[model samples]
Target: MNIPTRSAIFLSLLFHRTVLSLQPPAPRAIVVGAGPVGIAASLVLASRHGYDVTLLESSPETSIQTKYDPTKAFLYNVNARGQTLTKMFPNLHDKLVKRSVESKGFADATITVVPADPNLPIPKSSKLEKSFEMRNNENNEAGNAMPKSEKAVGVGYWIPRHEMVGLMVECIDEHNEKGEGGKISFYTGKECTSVSPRDVGGVFVEVYQADLVVGADGMNSKVRECLSHPRSAVGGWSLDCPKPNYFKLKKWRSPASFLRIKVLQLPPQFEIPDAEGNPPLITNSENIYAIRSIYKGPRNYLSLGLLPMKNNTAVRATNIVTRPDHEVWKLKDGNAIQTWFEKAFPRMNFNGMISNEEWDRFARAEGTRFPHCQYSRGMAVWDENGDSGVALVGDAIHAFPPDIGQGVNAGLMDVVCLDRALSGLDTVTGKEAKSAKENDKPSLGKNLARYQKQHSPEIASLIRLARFGAPYQYRQPHRADRILRTLWTLNVAMRLILNKITFNLVPPTCIILSQRPELTFRQVMRKADLTTLFLKVVVFGLIGLRFRPRLEILSMLKP
Candidate 1:
């Protein structure tokens, strides 16, 4: 029976190979965003899947035309997970690194613990700070003649979002010049107002019809809104809908996960010193300094984190993130905010670092909040005939605070996953295509569903992990809060050590461990939950032991 079955399978495969490959017509895709995720999605669809793409951006053409916009620019730490997309496109990783601050010589970090008294001198530098300084100085002296091994040790790249988008656009233009797989037509200031999931679903940027509509637009996505508040049916047709529609998506809203952020732009080559007020040994771009205070007062001191931009000319963008109701947010004017900065971070030379104009700018800047983390149940919804569909990618489907820095990386991975899910159609022969057509089974709808299934769980795990796992500590003014955070961190470290010593008997949680590129977020979450249970059991056992002695003593007294 096995021999006959194998023979039959071989004969079927041989017959299929003998048939001529019939390429299907390229499907038209309308991607409704020109941000990093949307642009990358366009590249994948056009180059890999041979889909003619129309890229629509709501921002006017002038905004992205410049090399960089300091006021609006923020740095993205593109780690290995986000860099995985480079494998699909040639030389993209190199291009990104060339324009970014590479991790090897430029990614050193220094932390200074400030004294309680504003008049008191800054504390001495720790061993970690000394080592960072040494390495940075060595790199500077060596200049561009660094070793290949050292260069290969780069953990990631720190690139501004606008610059990354510019690089992607360059890739698109190059692909166009060489006549790559499919052509992409880019249009700026074309906002997507509505969508109709009727026959050959259309995106109403300008009433353009397409086989598929991709919602790569940002958090305030119009496509997501369209899905949530679909046109109501009336008299056998949707009056609200500019046209008739068959598919009505179940209304869904993202779970609210909010964090307010204020961005401060500091000048390039600014002199920032150590806790002892000593000038840094290396250029500012090579290191990130965090100035924290020791005082536990009514109002928490500002915990300023300054992340660098590109190597030479880029200015530093400092983020002052806090709860929406934090005391810092209550400061009404620039003078009040400047006073807070001067009081909160005393060791730093604020006079030399930030000018009066800069303070005013920071005050005038209106901070933004992180969007809720959610994915639509109908991420890949289609019409009744299954011939046309709408798919969502990037922030349109899932978003959260950029606390973990996986926001952009996860969005890029979505495009790669979508491409993998739909790649199965390339093997369909003419006979199979005709059979699929006759049977009313277009593979596009099925493939999109497959993508949703494969991608949704990761999205869920990512959101949960980002929202709850190893949150960044801002070192509040309360000593109790600091003590508890320290204990929690030590406990995590202890579990990791135990797992190593006990030969995996005690599984370690994925707190900071979630950043490992080899492990998926789902895998990370599973390990985290299991480790949590193990710790709980150990804690209960210890409690039982401690009480057992007391109980025995009490029994003796009773006797």
Candidate 2:
């Protein structure tokens, strides 16, 4: 029989206490919404950031959407920002790259852009095609645009949105398999009914507890409602966001209703034509075509998009219908409406423009749906206070029409920036531990404030840019839109002239997403504005040079 000595027992207990002290506490993180951004944030926090992650989904599956046409699929555009995020998660990126459709070859040529009035003296559709290309710097501007070591200002990828969600879930599963980060617990179909602060933990969701709560839910997010709603004495916790910061935010919605009609691939005969009238655009290849239809008046407009499936002949057809100051229209009776489709796009392939029959079929297959997007100013990627253990990402904060195809791209960027912010926080709490004493509670809230300040200006600029870019895609009855559209026309004309004169003009400062990965959204906007202003000034100088006598007389007559 062996009995431990009192000294041995005392030494053992002391050693155990020391070991526990040395080990850092695994941060408890709960992510609401298992959508694309939610899943990505979950994996990164668990695997890369080493947080104990819990992912919750309201739906039974990541996406409950069921496709009516076996050939058709949902799609998304992953831009430079999204690509930057992909680089952070190698496994996620690798899987997506393998199965995804690459869009390097896509250009303005893929789509036809015509003036609303055919006789409006605009260039040929070929010349007016808009391509999503990253901008190169005129000088230090280009240098400033590239973030990190990523040098190329490359075009984004166009993969199905559902595929993105599915693949993200798979990547997260794989990360969980390795058990690298604090063990991740994922639950789907279990809705997050309520969220409040716990006495013991920082945040509480239903029965689970966590140090932080990240809400990546989409536009209609319940989690966002909780964050937005004022806390009550009985039910919710107060989020002490400063009053001054509240005034900085501008919230507004486009009252206009939009109708989105999606159809499976065009029949064999209805192929998207190229400039030369070659075989259909999606005949046997995997190229996508995005075209904006020209309407005769300011009342209505449409955007047509065709994306190919990776391994199948089926192409996804999307039609976005916009009429100024109108309510969302629906087709429920399965009545055929081929007349308008034929009139607008007589040259295209198989079926008529979204036939009522097809629309009804889709409605039956999926549920009744309407795509609505609203804009709010000064919404950074993260919520106000990180110390509150609450943060929001993706459509929860800012959701807008895909004017520049940045809906998901912006969301993905949110995760990337948040990841960086958290990484810095980890350093401060560990390697920068001594420095934490200088700033009390230096971990989440302080780093989140840094994120808020650093990222707010850029996201605000993006929101404004999206609003400005809206007229080109959607018809606007507002007088302001009319004026902006006129200015936009002038900008486009000046751009053409400058490119003609300089032999190499900088990319138009349209305030769209940058091609270079490094530049902030605000940086891109500033460069675009500068380019626009330069072009305008140059054009004015040219006018004076050509009409010197008239200008001199006019200047002398001015009172």
Candidate 3:
């Protein structure tokens, strides 16, 4: 007789167990905040890792309560890194696409660089490439032309935060209905007071005690603080240990429509071809450049962000400061927001055309009420060396500026890395010998440290790149560097450099190979020789091109 299939055996075992026993034990996890990072983390742990997760949100409702919320104003571009993580969770990407616009081209449509001086006799540069673009406008056609191919820079999807949240919640609900081994319970209108570790080496979080705690609380994290290190306790790891700074002081506003303005110079390296099909020559050495402000139009708007660098005083002037009782400025109500924009920006001949009503609709649709800013600028990971089973992921650990739209993506990467580490340890400990022993393998401590050590350098590098990535026309020195930096910033050039540097410097694959040296001779040869040869070729090409104009000429020669 043939043995039963794995699924059939599993189903038979499940049916034979008592109805109550069929349900998995509640593997408690308390998530502090219900924001994107928190929700995403909770879902991953609960759905993928078979952990019982509960998400806590301070708000009474799952949806955005405020009308003129600044958080809702902008759309998130889910890049390749983020999509890779979402793919781990079934149907997440499809759900997100249903609610948002996906694009693979740049929003600006054309790349143009301006000169440092308005009177300087410099030609403007415009180069068209396949760039990603997305808008929060509901009326927007799904796929619009932007003078380039969709596959030029890889796939990118644009979805509003609210819509993204809804999709995640739906996934959680669907998984729960199937009575899967794990579940994600949502708690609204609850605040976490503290987290403390039990004697048995599990985390205990205090909310309203009667409530379930699957600690996914956010940055002012009570769960992280209480469980890792209680305030009153003296010996164990303390949560009060300084949290990592992940953001800087920056504020952004939404414009009712795309504004067209003339500036002296273009933000660095953003060169555009002139009407004569020639690269616009750069003259001014300073970094100050200009661009025609392209505002989001009609009932939709583009966001205006303010990020202040250390010692950058000019950022203060551009901060969105509104009076307490301005006639047009009501902080939370969307209907009243347009009036504020009209009064504050007042459409003049120099300013682009945008109406108050249009601004209000866009603000309401995008959920733009509160001001958006980051207090820290990078990711933080804390590991308690002893018995305390504690770890952090997502924004709590690696927060970056939204300029590159990698916030969600980075967080997803953290989840994948952490999950893999946990799985690896389980396999080694013989915990995977049977199904019952799998979930019983408690606490990921050393594995977490390893994960942090492995991921931090790359995360830090991304933070640095984002910090210096975009060329700012407002700064004099940056404007000058833009031209020299342009090629490096482009998607094609950046990928080449990133591959070379990450592969050579980090050698993640090499590290993995060294750990698992049981490969075939041919396989080892490919990894050791072929990979190195490929990298050498790329490095040589990059270095050789610096002294020669052949590649540039070839590119220009292409139709």
Candidate 4:
């Protein structure tokens, strides 16, 4: 093929410009937060829908982390549910999988059980010692072997929060360079001080006005606060009481807010001595190691969960969790903290793993309190004219502990659900006519309302699930309580196995069967309730049957 002449190229450019000039202006959206959810939202809104998206972040450009940041180094396991969003863009999904450390359930994990109270006598007759021995024997026999059937379930790729955000930004930049979709303008150091419904139509984010506003700025969201508590925003004055144009979001905070977590930076390729001759540290970054301990007779306990970092250069980030009244919180100085660590984890070499600077940093860190799992009642709001719209996604609407590791996954699913609503997929079936014609622009108010209706119940269910379906681990202190929890878990597991073995009459536990793509959060909760009911019925029926013979004998003897 020959190259086109300059005149021909100029004419072609002129014709394209003329066509573009005749088209209607694109809708605009303002997304608050440059984090993973916000960036993904910007990509979808701009690319899928014809919207000029503006992404705003409070932090400066230079301040945004590109690597392992100790202060904000939280490990996120992007589960299969969350992967649905990334799969929307094949390139983005590939990039994420390439950078993340893949985990195939506990088959790749290690559990190191160290006694918190070293002085306490753990005889062979004790359950604790027996458990240790059993675990050791299993390790010796199987060598990190998991049941073949359980391999595919609960598969997630791990990535640091900031790194994942960085990858998202990079993808958006590449997409913008290609000029493939609608335009996106990203602004840094832009903090959203307030949000208000526009007088004519649309919403306002500080000085910038847009047709829609998305609040993904996290748990303490200004947009959520302003919209939900308008009276407080107006300084105790209520101007639009009778005909309030905005929707009010009411939230219920769960009671599980007592847990707290602190990040401890440790050296890579470190090993702890085990009874099986100090097995080399699994350097593939696939296995998670939990350094756990039992309750130290009347004293509080601190547990360490080590999330794998990339084997080579990245430092390991160990999450230490405890209650506010735990003994670890009372340590005043760095030396005290270091000594405490040495005493608490005698197996692991804390002195060699943590540097003096890291110890000082750990000592100064106040640690993050696990926020109560809360969900908003009304997540979407629009003006009376049905032109302006606002929606809450991610932590802004539902904030909870990371016990379930659904923080990022649930947030991403929220975006996907919103996308489905906007596309009219929720209402219209294949080849079925939509409520609006093909040429008609999507209704912001109607779609947002649809999203609210579809997503609210799921959010409520997720919050409830996070509150109760969470595993105890060491959240419970007493030995008897731990034993009860273990028995209950085993009972549930056995019931599920029996169900599978039979015709599947009994429902599975929400905690174990949550990651199945087919089951939504609401379905998970319902199944868990069903399983509990089934168990209760079985127990009481057995009890009545066992006492029936005794009752009959006593009746015959007595008048």
Candidate 5:
């Protein structure tokens, strides 16, 4: 028999008979952590696939019951990639947007490339103008072709992390209310101590026992450690992976990821009219301004961040300081439980720009910190026999610097890929009774390995993109070399290039499209366009970087 024919026959025979007798009668899953990724995973497994899921959370019950704060927002830009996944899951996008601030297009902002010099006043204009002009031209073309109504194609939503969490919680509740085939039970304030895999079968996890476990947990994941070390007596695995020394030779990889912010002093209502005659609108109580100034002095313009640093931690928190004057006071209680703003601004003088009342009100409204402010990229995955049933999505897999605004978008794409993979299996198995029987055999190891292999490369690329983008977008003059300093005004161009490269490189599975069956092909083309645009921008940006002169303007600007 021919090889193809023989393979087909083998497949048919395998489908007819169960490949492994170790299959469980009913598949039950436990997801650790109640963060966005964990919640998303639970919803997909339970709501879509009808799998029984139990989510374990370490927080206390009271905390879960409280309303979300807008101040502690996770600024998200749901790119086409992530949106595609959201489309797959019903009502997720709408709910997320409703509670979050949406950005229709890139915000008008500037980045100063020169190192901050305290002795010198911050420059009024840098290379930002040229960057803006270039971006404007691109926007004009894209805008003309896009419909007026749809022109608001979401770059993404600036949403509070807690808000997203609340929405996920609501969705889970709704699913349970609908009398769905599967159910989700959330255990709050309960922590998982350890997990041990059974020699005969499934893993046995010991949590608070008061609560159950479902999906993988966050940073402090007990299940993950257990799975990584099946032979360990104590449940927790050694941080090191159990593999050949050759595997140890594998290089550590960093992906492109960052959090970018456009900061401007709240211009006075009267002075809001700029040279362009465009008046800054008051969306809320605080006045908005469109000023682009570069920080040049002893202090650095931007700081690199990973996890939220504690008060004593050396890693400085970006955007705002740790302590501010304003505090939140509830009407019923004379005592104030929550403080509005934490840190004071030491460098930029607000002196006359802000009124005491305005500051107070601003403090009352925003509570000190900015909302929708963090971003990251990359997801975590592990390899086992070229397949990885265990994989991470969203913040769990890859957390990036918030500069590029791709954190949530990247995570959402992860969902899309994962869902698609799972759905494909479901579709194939459902079509034939023999196939369904065969599918009943679960290879946890194989699936986890596949998840890791498929996701790692993409995650690595994103991390690199983010790292490159963060310095440019934030214009951390301290980190810039001599060449970048000379052309400080051209920093925006650098950002545009970085944006293009990262976006273009993003995989197609990440972009969201209208679910209309007929439009599927068009969606694919749109993804291609996004990718092409990114590549072109990246190539041009690099060229621009190389050709831009370092001496001409520096001589003129020297005081």
Candidate 6:
């Protein structure tokens, strides 16, 4: 009994060694979808936020190939809404900018408002599109209602998606190596069917349970399928006339759809100024620019944007044709490919730019296509399914027309916001050291709820803008909406009137947005939605008058 007191001290020391040496393993995170978004998410979480991550991707060969493939890779535009990474990930941003063609001085997007009549001649001169000097040099110099882009030095940047992807992967890897033993693993060719939901805040991803399952897995996500309601609808997939549900429930619809897209890679010579013995420039501006055309038909329209590739090796153009998916199958033959290109794009010729064999490759190859709008942004960030913490980011939560250039941007933005949301997360172990109870993990409910509340508005805005601007931006407007075209004629007339009144010598035509990086999709979308009837009438009238960009014409009318 007198010797017993020493025994208690030995037991205490034994317990300390056992618990301290084997502390709960760091919370494990599984990221599905190894695209730029998913990779970015994994990088941010591991290198910056310090989370163990395993990234899984479905496509092995397809996603990595960025060669001059008509079917696989296409050009991408990064706008003000997407330029936030410049500050957050400066190294990554700088790397991407270096690989991308500069859109400020060397190249910018020229929104050409062209008359749909095939007979109309496309003006080849660059002077027709106004310049920043021209905008400010007006006699009146009234800047009252002008969009800020007119005053800025640049619009945005364009990079081929594949090249961007490669650069991003490189950046992530380089940065991650410096991390202090951060667990980051990536696997390709893993098409996850369905994952078993865990109880304590992780999922049994093919038997290896993780602490969190993030579905960065695009529109048609099986992880989304796991969280979504069995019977549901989202975007064009559920075009049923009745109301099944809105954002309240998990809704998965039919296979998502996309316009039969035809992408082309032209010789660098394609962008040479036509005024300098070249072909037609999209705008009248003398600066090298990416051309965005809003070709207006009687009832339908098409929005085409083309940009120069890195080192000026090639020019890339994307043609979004609204055809039945079944009809626009793979390339039939070289003649068919040539005929299709000639028919879809009558203005540009690829004869010398691309050989017949190349054209066939362009037409025949199956390119990357996204869903029209497949999965709902439904389900909670951390809901009690079997018992895991499941969340979705990127196209899984919000993907639609892709008009606002929000696909990659939205996903990147989501990662930043989510990281902020889970800043002080406790990283409670799900089942390794705790009870099998769902409540065993530290509460992440409020943190997740706050994330959903704060982020959903932007995503909602994304959906709203995408759908509303779809017809106007590219597809066909309604018969009633077409009346606005007559009004656009008045809009052009007003620009001419103001230019005359102000004693400005510049030609008065339609004006396009400067594609300013500071210009938010929400702001632009709101203005487009609430535009006065008279203004719409004027803007539409200008289009009827063959005035291209309504923004410039409207600014001229600003008192």
In terms of lDDT, the poorest run of 10 residues in model 6 is 235-244
| Per-residue lDDT of candidate 1, residues 331-367 (tens digit) | 7677787787776666556777777887877787768
Deviation of model 4 at 26, angstroms: 1.6
Candidate 2 residue-wise lDDT, 26-107, digit = tens:
8889998887788878877887768899998887864452223332355676766787778788877887787676654233
> Which regions in candidate 5 have their CA more than 4 angstroms from the true location?
1-26, 62-66, 69-71, 107-155, 208-216, 219-295, 300-318, 321-390, 424-444, 479-559
Task: State the C-alpha lDDT per candidate.
Answer: 0.64, 0.57, 0.44, 0.71, 0.43, 0.53
Model 6 scores a TM of 0.65
Put the candidates in TM-score order, highest first: 4, 1, 2, 6, 5, 3
lDDT of 6 by residue, 278-347 (tens): 4554322212332323333432344444435565444445554443333336456777767755555455
Cand. 3 Cα-lDDT: 0.44
Q: Estimate each model's TM-score.
A: 0.76, 0.70, 0.52, 0.81, 0.54, 0.65
Residues 2-51 of candidate 4: C-alpha lDDT, one tens digit per residue: 99999999999999999999998889999998788888889889889878
TM-score for candidate 2, residues paired by index: 0.70
Q: Across residues 1-559, which tens digit of lDDT does each residue of candidate 3 receive?
A: 9989999998988887867687656555666788766777777677766777767788887766222234333446676657766777768878766655455444222333332223333333333332112210222422221223212245666665565776787777888898775687887887777655444445555533211233344444554445433134443433433332222222222111111211111122223223334444432211222232233232222222222111111111112221222222234454455444433322212112334444444344322122232222222223253333445566654433343455676666566666665554332122332333455444444444444445555455444433433322111112223343333234323333444676644222221222221332123234544445665887899889785688788889999
Best candidate (score: lDDT): 4
| Alpha-carbon runs more than 4 Å astray in model 2 | 1-25, 63-74, 105-152, 232-240, 243-249, 252-282, 289-304, 313-315, 324-331, 338-359, 362-388, 425-441, 474-487, 495-507, 531-559
Model 6, C-alpha of 386: deviation from truth (Å): 13
Candidate 1 has an lDDT of: 0.64
Return whichever of 2 and 3 wins on lDDT: 2
Model 5, span 452-497: residue lDDT tens: 4454555555554444333333333332332453243233334334
